[model samples]
Target chain A: MNIVKLGYKNIADRPLSTLLSLLLLTLGVGMIALLLQVNRHIQQQMENNIRGVDMVVGAKGSPLQLILSAVYHIDAPTGNISLHEAEQLRKNRLVAAGIPLSYGDSYKGYRIVGTDHQYPELYKAPVSNGRLWQEPFEVTIGATIAQNLGLQIGDTFMGTHGMGEGSEIHDEHPYQVVGILGYANAVIDQLILTATESVWEVHHHEEEKSENHPGEENHAHEEADEKHSETTAHDGTPGEEREITAMLIRFRSPMAMIQLPRMVNENTNMQAAVPAYEINRLFNLLGVGVDTLSTIALVIMAVSGLSVFISLYNALKDQQYEMALMRTYGATRWQLVWLVLQEGLLLAGLGFLLGILFSRVGLLLISGLMEARYHYSFSGGEIIREEWQLLVASLVIGLLASLLPAVRAFKINISKTLAYD
Target chain B: MLITRSLTFSYDHRATFQFPDISLEAGTDLLILGKSGIGKTTLLHLMAGLLSPGTGHVELMGTELQTLSPAKLDRFRGRHIGLVFQRPHFIRSLSLQENLALVQYLAGKRQDKARSQQVLESLDITHKRYDRPHLLSQGEQQRATIAMAVLNNPQLILADEPTSSLDDTNCLNVASLLKQQAATTGAQLVVITHDHRLKAHFQNSILL
Candidate 1:
């Protein structure tokens, strides 16, 4: 009996046109919603991982790669840096803590990061069970590694020669899992951590045995017996021969932000990359792609708005008799206008809701693919605060699209329309 | 009561209409006779306040419609006048009873389902109450149109060609139903149509 009911029925009277407009609106809004969720989650993860580390010191290469390799553990290191020279830079008065990373191997695609206890402390990843690695070849698995590989406290696995899964297995040196770190939303959650000496010792033993008996079968078993004897006298100390992939540095004070990166880049052989600068550059490069996608989505939204306007205008032309009849029954012209406008709002409102649901399903599918490919988890169920702004924008589009049609309804000639019947 | 004085209207000044002055007391019936294209529907629209006259005032129950603002005129028309068009144009989505209920609602009255049912019963279309407007026969739709006109118990009921397309029997039935509903509601009835068959039905008639 209300105008809303009348409006709803009028919309229902033309199901095909309504469905077409709704489909267009849903596609536009769904694309925008999907982009918002994905971009927010990526930005959040990047910000979370780059919290403690102020700068990364690694072999000279793309500074962005240095941050991605050291902070995110997602890219290859630029090259190796001398551990003794790196230690000298770490001793600068401005340095708070400098944790070295030496990773040349992985077990089933999970990188084995060789570092000190300060590495775990930086990410606040406490051992949930058992204890941290205290000796070479004794490793600590991250929460994701343990859950994925079914590695318990006493499980033992041999590292591969390269970072990927299909490299040569270092059977001469087996790493025993001494602890499993708790879940932390940082790079540590996907890494296998151990003392830097373990990386050096495994490579040193393999080099010596290969040189002594080249291409001999079963030499790895013999080399395992010699692993203890090949350990350096100063086991955990960084020496001339020892090298690391990168060093993650935190500043002692804000003064370090200005002087430290410049000093290391100019004076030392290592290149110092500021994490914030590299990540900003990376997001700027990514922003272009995301902005292009958003523009396309906006264009689609504009097209849908046109469709809504066209359909409403056509419906007004078709329903002139009905409108005149309503006027004859005591409905004001403005009431007729409101009826048309309400139909537009109802269509947009329903389309927005359906678009949000469509985006959620799209996010679920994208998250599943991301998890399978990158081992990165994105809980897409988190609500974006910007969606409310999107809702308001959608309503504005609805309102604007119906404005002309509503005015046409307001100016209808009731006498002429009724006379035509 | 209803009265008008020298009502006139034109579109583009090509065919101007100067309507005759008339008055009707409460609870009485009047038939306005005119040939097709003689401004009969336009006159009905003018009386219902759907169209404003170019030169005169339509006064219903002592309120001059032309003097009121468009908004106030609409409210005045809703509360005090009822209109029925040539074709029965109920909100096609609603059933017969709901259409009458909608009439009351649009007139700013509380929806009384019982009153709608009573109106339907009085018109002997209570069996078609729950049916959509398109589902009803021509005679039933006309009765339902009358039911809507009387839903607000308005002071003046204006029907524009309410029986133009009906046969002899159906036309007689629709005219009687309009008069019966108008008399029962104590409203002055005005039926404007070109059908000469209705000339014998009303005591007060005007020809154009």
Candidate 2:
């Protein structure tokens, strides 16, 4: 009865053409939407995990690897730095807070981080039950580990000798869960936290057993006495000869930005990695990939717009009689023009809606695969603010594509058309 | 009532048509008969304000259509003039009832569902009220077209070649329907056609 109804009928009359145009539009929109979501998720993950830790200092190696391992907990650590050297950097006037991490063991693929209370504090993670680890063998599990491993308070598990699932078991020492941290949605959610002495004690005990007893299990009674003495020695003592994987540093002022990394790189054997710089470089690398994908998506969108134009222009020729008929029904030139434009908009609107749904479905599939591969969780239901710009872009494409066809409809010679009919 | 004076049209200055001045009172039928290419369709378009003549004034219900701006002229034509083409065409997406409703809407009249139903009933096509135009038979579509034309109850109705494609019985049926519907609405009806069979149907007849 109205232009919209007529437009819808016109589209329905050409299902194949409509579907082709819609498919192109959906793919283009879906790609852009997927890119936006992924870029936002990566940016959020990187920013949230960094959490005000200004620099990472570790044994000289890839600085990015140090930040990724010690800060993000997603890569291998850049060897170990002496605790004496770590303490020296912590005492610097430019350093506000220094959180040391010793990572050499794992519990079911989840890294067991040996650190003080500042590790959880840096990520604003609080204990949901019990308390922070206070002793060598007492451990606090992050929320995800506790849920995945189903380890409640008072449950005990022995650590593995390496930082991954398959490694030599350190059965000489057992770690008990003293607390479970609340979910902080950061890297800390996937870690198990313990005091720095736990990692050292586990390895140190292994070294003692290897040197003194050489795989003698019957010496368990003698081992208990040795552990009892070692525990007393661990209390209130800085094991200066021990080494930690890395130290997370916060600058006391902006002056440390220029002075601290330069001082560490030149004067010490440790390498200082600025998180902001590393993350920026990482984003630039990722941006190139995303930009190329988005450009391809935009080209697809442009092609779809052209398809809409061609479909409408071709349909206009076939519907010239119909246009003349409408004029006979007293439709004005503007109404005829609106009819074509509405057809274009209807196509775009449907394509945009289906495209968004397609993107969300794709995100759901991608999220599942990513979680299985990387153990990094990405939620799929977020609607980014940038999608509004995509909406406007689609509408403009629809409008522009329909322009000539609508004008053709406007200038249709009603008398001549009907005369031939 | 409808009146046209000094109506003339030329196509690209190659062919010209000088139409006979015509007049008709309310509730009457006039047939302008012509063979092919004698400007019969052009004359109907001019009266419907779909086209402007080379020289003339078409006064329908006391308004000179050519004097109005294109927008106003379109609005005026919608409000006061009803057109029925030989090949009946409806917005194919709309149902029979919706097609009638659209006529009233485009004419800037209040949409009265009851009035549309009554018009379809008078045309005896009310049984197909919700059916799409394409689903209707040829005769039913023609009646639906008449329903659209008379839906607005305009003072004047111009039908272009209403029975040119019909057999004798259908031709007579359509002509009587136009006359009967115009009488029922109290509107002047002008039907242009090349069909010689319709000449006996209208008392006021002219040859172009």
Candidate 3:
């Protein structure tokens, strides 16, 4: 009965073209929104997990891989560096806190990392259950690890020799979960924390068992050199030249940012990598693909706008006399103009709503895939600020697409049309 | 009363129309007969205020419609005048009742559903009020069109070739219905057409 109802009926009468425009708009907006969401997730996950660790020093390899393995615990470590040499580097005045990580073992596909209290302190993850691990074989599991593997406090489970499932099981040295960590929204939530000596002693026990029982369970260590276990003063246990996977270092001042990384690379066998720098490099390398995808989405959106224009234009041509009839019934030119514009705006608004739905569903599917592969849950259901701008852009498209058509409606000659065109 | 003097219009420099003076009192009817190319529709358009004449005066009930602003003229026309054409056009998307409501709304009147139903009933087409215009028969459509025209009860009713496309029986029915509705509303009626069948229905006749 009203202009809005009239405009809506006009669109509803032509379902095919309306649906086509909506489909294109939904796809374009959904693609851009999904890309924006994933980029936000990756940036957030990287930044939060690398908070206090200024640099990583590991055995010589790719600096990016060293940061990925030592800091994120998502990649294989760049070989092992000497613990004695690592301890000597930490003694320097420029280094404030050095947390050494040693890991090559997994229980149920969750990596078991051997490090000190500094690692938990860096991510501010408080032990929510019993306590932090204090002994060689006792473990404090992260929240994700505890939930995924269904391990509770005081539970004991044997760890495999390598980083994933289906590796050699070291059944003799079953690790006990002494505590469970609270959620920190960091990489620690997916790790199992134990003392540095646990990784060393597990291999030590394995080596001796192989020597006595030789050639059984020795294939796992056939490439590793046998270390001489003499009584060492470090922990009062018989040990060899101990090795660690990497050391995560925090600086005493900003001066270390200039000197520390270069000094480690030049003066020692270890390589230093800055987490912030490496992550930026990673994004820079990925930015080209992101740009290309964004351009495609924008192009699709423009085409949807064009489709709206064509549909409205064609409908207007067929309804010229109907419009003239309205004018003769005392409707002003502006009223007729608004009728057309209202149809365009209505389509744009509907397309935007459907597009948001498309993106959120896509994000959930990606979240499930990420949980399965990387154990990083990007459960982002909140709308970011960029979509508001997208909403404005969509309205603009509707307006621009209807501009000429509305003008034509405004300029309609009532006499010529009603005289029966 | 409705009056127009020295009305002139042109689509271009080559095609021009200068209409004769017209005046009609309330509760009476006038029929204007002309051949196809004699500007009968143009004269009706000028009097309905659907077009601005090159030079003229169109006055209805002491308000000079030609002197009003474009927007004001539209409102004046919506409030004071009703127009009908040969094909009995309507907003095809709306049902018959909705079209009447739309007309009432455009004329700055309240959407009086009861009044619209009463008008359609008087015209004997109230049974088809819920149907779309395209779904109605030709006689039913003409009656619905008359129902819409008189829904506002305007001071003037103008019809341009209103019965040109109808058969003899339906043509007399529509012409007499227009005259009866105008007499009921106490409005002046002007019918311009090439169909001479309408001459018998009006008291005053003019040939252009």
Candidate 4:
């Protein structure tokens, strides 16, 4: 019989032990697969958001928190900077383009971003239908928000006061959904964008009427007066005149990243955060656990290798007489060793298949949860190249595991074994 | 021809066997009768090149079995020696025909389907050639092992208790078949057993 056939026979003879070993190997490999795919997906999402913004400027606080809240729409914003201070930074000759973001409002769980028309232009996100938000109380929804809320171009919705659900709603001034942005696989596709004036209108509608007295009503009714009347009435209004959540700054030169953030912190109350630095810091913090997990996996694989050796050793001990009989019938010791190692290869190969199967099933379940709660999309597809490497590595380790038992088989005393009975 | 000279073996530092000289020519059937643990199986193993004698030399056809390396000894044994164990030790996973084919392949002999079938037919196990050893009866498994042993047509046939578990009729049949096949191949046949019922079948006898 060929070596492969012999290996197959050995595995078939001990079906339960073979299956248990394979299941253990699959657990280690499957975990590595899931971690690798999720890490890749997160990195892709981060890079997409960091493309247009060269620097982030927010009120003095943790730089990492500022970047997380600004770029990924995850954490809460650090406190706001003054509007006059932001306008000064925008006017600098080194600055190329700046887009301001006003927050503190949301619809359902999705953040309602109050920014200019340049906000969508900054992300290069095109409106899938209708026009951009131009009038007060007009809004443009993201693709996911539109789909989930079943809101079309003409549908109107009320904005809430805070970021999460159960926040107080501004039922007095309802907003109309005038447009929907196409999917960009970024944060823009998961937020609601409108004019900055719309945010001021919702919060300062009561303050506007209180300042218009009986004699000043005729002046407020004038065309030019009506435009400046709201600004004059709430001149100290924190909601209307206060700074925004964060500013996205792009420099004309890449060297501005190094020279500009230091200049901003030294010259103003705002702090600048570099996306790359914070991302690396985040990975370093997370990488320790990932590395520890990988080390544990390697150790488990080594144990599994020893398991293969011990099991094969026992099997050879039990089959001594049979081995001697084969030897007498012209079988070489090297051929016998090959037969044992072949079993190891078969076990590893089958275990790898099971590992890949479990990874896909795991990814599918995770994707369902992410889509339902966070509205994030995940695709089920072929195994990536890195996952394939894990499989090949497992096989190599298995082959190494079988080496000791194979050597023992080669050194067996055929004559003594035959003569013992 | 098989020859041994001053062959000595020990167990636990105590000498168990000392054969000064013995030679068996081709086509001779020798029945070895000994008590249990008398080194009968050991002597057969020495003649079959399965064990090395510490004190002296054993030669089969012209090559000294003691002078060869372990690897060369294994190859020599596979091509020149045929051994039947006390109980048939067939590889349980393989069919009877595959068992025979593996013996031929390991001996570097071309697979001869006609010869394999003929051996099976002689043992009346031709119908069970495709069955695993576990599916066969004790006598049938023993016959299959015997068929595999003779598949390569070795220079010497060594049987260790060939009829230990068989009925009287089957024992006589197995003994006659071993002698007939050895005579046909012009090979020396050595039967090592404590069973005295097998003594009358062979002309030459050694009592230990």
Q: Estimate the overall C-alpha local distance difference test score of candidate 2.
A: 0.84
lDDT of 4 by residue, A211-292 (tens): 5555644432332211111211135665446666688888888778778899999999898898888988998999998889
Write model 2 residue lDDT over B122-187, tens digit each, in one string: 889888998998788889888988888888887888898888788888999999999998898899
Chain B TM-score for each model?
0.96, 0.97, 0.97, 0.95
Candidate 2 residue-wise lDDT, A1-421, digit = tens = 5667768978997888999999999999989988888778878888998878999999898877778878887776767788888899999999999998888577887878889998888999989999999999899998988887899999999887555455567897899999999999888888989998888888677666756886664343243322111121122355656788889999999999999999999999899999989999888988899899999999999999999999999988888987777666667889989989999988988888888988888888887786655556776466778998888888889999999999999888887887787
Candidate 2: give its CA RMSD in angstroms.
4.7
What TM-scores do the predictions have? 0.90, 0.92, 0.93, 0.80
- What tens digits encode model 3's per-residue C-alpha lDDT throughout B1-208? 8889899999789988988898888788899999998888888888888888899888899888878887777777887888988888888778899899999888778999899988988998888888888789888888888888888998899998999899999898998899888988899999999998888888899998
Over A346-375, each residue of candidate 3 has an lDDT whose tens digit, in order, gives: 989888889989999999999989888878
lDDT of 2 at A234: 28
Q: Pick the candidate with the highest lDDT.
A: 3
User: Which consecutive 10 residues in model 1 chain B have the weakest lDDT in total?
Assistant: B70-79
> Which lDDT tens digits does candidate 1 get at residues B11-92?
7678899899999998888999988888888888888888888988889998888888876777677778888777888777
> Taking chain A by itself, what TM-score does each prediction score?
0.91, 0.91, 0.93, 0.85
TM-score of 2: 0.92
